[model samples]
Target: MNTKPSSNRRLLAYALVYKYRIIAAILILCCAVVAELGGPYIIKTIIDGHLSLDEGDMTPVLALLGGYLGLLVLAGAANFSQSYLLQSTSLQIIKNMRMDLMRHVQRIPIRYFDNTPIGQIVSRIANDTEAIRDLFMSFMATFIVSILQLAGIYTALFILDYRLALFCLILPPIFVLIMYVHLKYSKGYITIMRARLSDMNATINESIAVMPIVQAFRREKKTLEEFEVLNEDRYVNQVKQFRVFSLSSRNAVGTIGALVTAMVVWYFGGNALDGAIRFGVFYIFIDYLGRIFNPIIGIFDQLTNAQRAFVAADKVFGIMDMEGVEVEDASSAKRPEGAVKFDNVSFGYKDGENVLKGISFEARKGETVALVGHTGSGKSSIMNLLLGFYEPGEGAITIDGRNVANTSKQELRKHMGIVLQDPFLFAGDIKFNVSLYNERISPEQVKQALRDVGASTFVEQLPGGYDEPVVERGSTLSAGQRQLISFARALAFDPAILILDEATASIDSETEGLIQRALKVVSEGRTTFVIAHRLSTIREADQILVLHRGEIVERGNHDTLMALGGRYYKMYQLQKGERVAV
Candidate 1:
């Protein structure tokens, strides 16, 4: 019944992806540890065998120096090889994990994004993944090297003297206890610290994205205060975390090292006082003990990073574990005829509260259906269902007499295109944004689509023409220009179903005229749905549905609605300053 893998298990699973390289690196490190340990014993041998004597053979001492130097060379070479292997392997794992998180994010439903801040998602990808890389590089590497170093040192100690070596075996359990106590005290701080960091990131990103509005409304100080609160919270938690870290890591390790050193000196010095311990043997035990704690200190130093990485791992993997919409490729058989219908459909973003109630309408091929409604009147909800953005709570939506729900969302959207009130553009050339790098849309189509939507007038005057470098979100372009590019983008795909949601609400009259002309041409042989507040643009629509309070109160052509003198009549008159219907 346990669906979630523990953090340890998850890390082991990802590490196994490069098991071969990790294994090879660990093996090389073990060899290096043994080779490095050999030098101390050799030094001890030379001291007791030759240096301590009144006279000794010079040839034997010379031979021992050569052997000691060779062990150092071997250790140096092995250390370099293992370091290179571990670093490269760790980098690749993190790279793959970051990429995987990004890809999964695309398949996540719109609902998750609606509730989650974009900054949190971004922090997970950019910052959290970077922390995980440290887990493998510093934590895993140091821990592994420490284990090998301890084994070599203890092996050397037992050879020198068994009783002291057995006493040293207790070091592992003591370090484990220190780490446990540190985690018990500091885990709360780390969790809160990371959450605050994510909150800060989200707040900063949101503020930067809406900076123009913030500055226009003179809310910069307020925004800064909001960011400052999150930053301060993070700082407080981090200080607390470091407080625990400072006590548990180097200080504890150093204290343990000093205690061990005192005991060994006492034991060995007592025997030396009795003239039973050799100078060389006594020196080697001290040397081996120092060697042991050097690695112990190193391993302990990475504990804080290791804990942060564990929390970061939970975040990165949690996203990957979210059940994303399965990627279903569009059907390739034929283009749709674009006959769309909503049959008594009811829907809501929240259960038991329908935003769209009992909506039923049909638009045959080549018909222009205009949806007119005040804010929150379910006009956009109808389009959302038709485009497979959300499912209808009750009843079904169909295209060409077949239920749309039977097909995958990708398949349903293949023949559809939509332009929102606020159009978005990416950081790319004008042509690239139009085609969106779809190979099916050629250079010829990009030019013609621009011409069709009247974007060419301004585009041709730019230095790069279609290749003009657009900054982030096309901030450099005019509102009308961005809308027109989005229009061209929709048209270049030449979709069978086109929905324009308040597409002309922000444009100047001249730009609206260009779009109207483009709409006249593009609506032929396609099912076009327009959600508009500007009633004049929908005058020639084949059908006009006026919605109020999640229900269509009136339905007819613009002329018929005017003649009926209903809600549509009153709304139109209000916009045009007409006292009565014309």
Candidate 2:
């Protein structure tokens, strides 16, 4: 999206939601302006009306001086009130905008995240929103006040002398030309700067997350060099932006103002000497001239801020505009009976190349179906489809005779549970991790789940048992311990359909034996699918399907497949260390 009229309109709409606060701030600002404008007028009256008369009227001079001081005090107080109101209102608007952005992001499709960087998404939600907040808190308020002050100054100048007011109009067009040139060149550079910063953040996040790999390979120098390149790119763009600001912002406007001031003196000074102009009017015009140019310079300076804010708004709205996943109403959702079937399904992450081609499978309730394949043989793809993470490219996936493609993921996953190869744990107590903070799951249920998974053996030895603290990603826990907790988590949920994808691969032999016994109890009546690299783990499975490439080549019980002496027989032999000739 372009950072122009449309983006500006959307930003304004965000602020306009708090219209009453803005109105109050504007009213206070006007009062401040009145007090500010009174200062120069009072000084002009003292100099021209009283002091110039040479009547030795000390009383009038003292009264005007006292009034000037009072105006300054009033202006300060009003300015403070206006600033406080505007800042408070801006914060409220920012909070609302951020909340909406976060909610929108949560509803977006998983595919959006697949292609986008986490750092870029974070930058939009955090850094860019903060920039937009600065725009509202400072730039927007300052720009409005500056424009009003300029209008007031121009009105006073015209009332004092029409000729000078007409001459001042020529300077604005010149200022506009300079500002236009600056914006044209600086905007592209600013965009580059923001992009480079996001790239730097992404690199930092990736590097830190994989620090162990980098250190193990001793690649610190290479990583540092890569980071330096991104940093330098951002620095170069910043220098370019600074050059544009120096040439066309306050300094450029100030030069024009000086020339205008010189012209005023030459023309009006001669008129004053001939007594054609009142001294009081001359003083007012000169003071108003300074007032007018200061705000004009401020406006040009704030243009940079305006440019930044608009760019940020464009990025924020870009994400907000993306289409999100559809949500189904809970009242309309149907409960699956744990019987899953994939009928001639074909699929791929991208077009024109299928990962699972015309594959068919069924796992009835109370049955364990095991899938055996190489890494890319589409085992995980089947699970992704079963969980409604992706729809099949052709044919249908159904749970209890209801097509999964037509169902919302929330509804499809309600009765399903999955334990991945690499189990993840959030930072919390053991009980919280097992129950995932689900208040519906009682403390007794959480303890029972741990017992069911044989996790209580090690957990009970910990100081707090179920309440034992778990650090981030459960780093303090052993791999076997983490796996057991994940099993407990799935068991606690009590899903009707359970999937274990290499869930025991990383565990030690002793822990695997324990898990094997636990699995028997947990999979008692639930429909289960197991994807195993270790052939021994699925020996008791009711059905075994051997997949090669994207198609299943053999299917039967362990003894039946072994008797056939085909692919499964060769794989089992290889795992058992029997030398089978290629």
Candidate 3:
């Protein structure tokens, strides 16, 4: 995409929604410009018409002074109104843009998040949006005012002396060339700087999130060195941008302005001394020339901010442009019957490389199916497909005879609950975490669900019980405690289908025993699928599927699989620490 134009058009579309405010701001800006431009003309009139009149009438001079004061007051009022309207309009647009961006992020598919960093996403939403706000508030305002002021100055200069006005016009094209070169060269640096900033944020977030691991491994020095490298990369790009601005911005423009002014003086000074020009006219031209260059310098300085805003807009738009891969058919919205079936379902994260190869399974209502496999044996991939996080590469998955692929994710997930190995808890009270703040799940139900999962013991022992505050990621709680709470959360939803993905892998034996009892109670009337690493846990499952290399090599209940003495038997013996040949 033509980044600059595309970003500008999108921003303009946002601003145009409040067209009346923009029109009012523009009108006020015009008034302010007129009032400001009148000042130099009034001074010229006083010197040429009043002072040289050789009149002893102090009244005319006093009246001119009063007129000048009124003009200044008018200019001040218009300027204030213009600034307020523009800034308020800008803020409104920013608010709308940010809300839309957040909503878009929510609708994005899970796979996009799998490959994209959270910190990078956060930077676009927070940091980049703020930069865009700067564009509207300061950069756009300064640019418009500078252009208007330059035009006004040239008009006034031409009226006083067309010859000098023509000379003044020559400098703008040169200024344009300087700015063009500066922006062209600085574009690559700004893009690099923004990318490096995202990298730095990602590094910082990763480091902080894994600080405990770093300390445990005694790799703090290595982490710090990695962070320094990212930080230095960003800093280097920033310095390069600064160097580009320094060479092409204010100082360079100022030098050109001075040369133009010196040329105008040499041309006009001789004419004034020779009585070929009025002294007031000469003075007015010089004053207007100075006024012209000031805004030009301001414009060049603001261009740097414009460049940054464009880069930020580019980043923000990139995310907004993504269309979610998961599309829900409206006609397929219906409640599931808890009979989950995967028929020859194959999938892959990358093209031409299947993760689940023709895997087939069925878990009827009120049945518990355990999936046992080594890592990368397609256990989790099966769960992912079942949950609609991914679509199969071949065949189909169905719930109660309805194809899951055609169903809306919201509808498919409405009757489903999941508890991952590492349960994630938001920062809230225990009750809020349990219910996930769903209004439909009452406080009584929340308490009952916690008690069912045997989490109420630890929860009630806390100082505030259900209201006890949970810090970010539930870091204040133990692993088992978090898992128990997650179990309660899933049960509180009263889902028809429950998925326990290695739920007992991280808990202590005593906690696991408590969870096992709780699990039976919760799974009694729901279609449950357990992806288990420990073989002992799934001994009582209605069916156990042993997965190897993305295919189900053995399928039966615990005793039947053990008698067969296949892959499942070998895995079972290996877990029991019994001797088994590879």
Error of 2 at 22 (Å): 2.2
Q: Per-residue lDDT for 123-166 in model 2, tens only?
A: 89998898899899878888878877877777777777888789
Which residue pairs of candidate 1 clash?
none
TM-score, predicted candidate 1 vs. hidden true structure: 0.96
Strongest candidate by lDDT = 1
lDDT computed for candidate 2: 0.87
Question: TM-scores of the models, in the given order?
Answer: 0.96, 0.93, 0.95
**Model 2 misplaced regions, further than 4 Å:** 1-5, 50-66, 326-335
Cα lDDT computed for each candidate against the true fold:
0.89, 0.87, 0.88
**Candidate 3, pairs of clashing residues:** none
After aligning candidate 1 to the native by TM-score, how far in Å is the CA of 449 from where it should be? 0.6
Angstrom error of the Cα, residue 55, model 3: value is 7.4
Task: Candidate 3: list runs displaced more than 4 Å.
Answer: 1-5, 51-57, 325-334
Tell me model 3's lDDT, rounded to 2 decimals: 0.88
* TM-score: the better of candidates 2 and 3: 3
Candidate 1, position 136, lDDT: 91
Model 1 alpha-carbon miss at residue 48, Å: 1.5
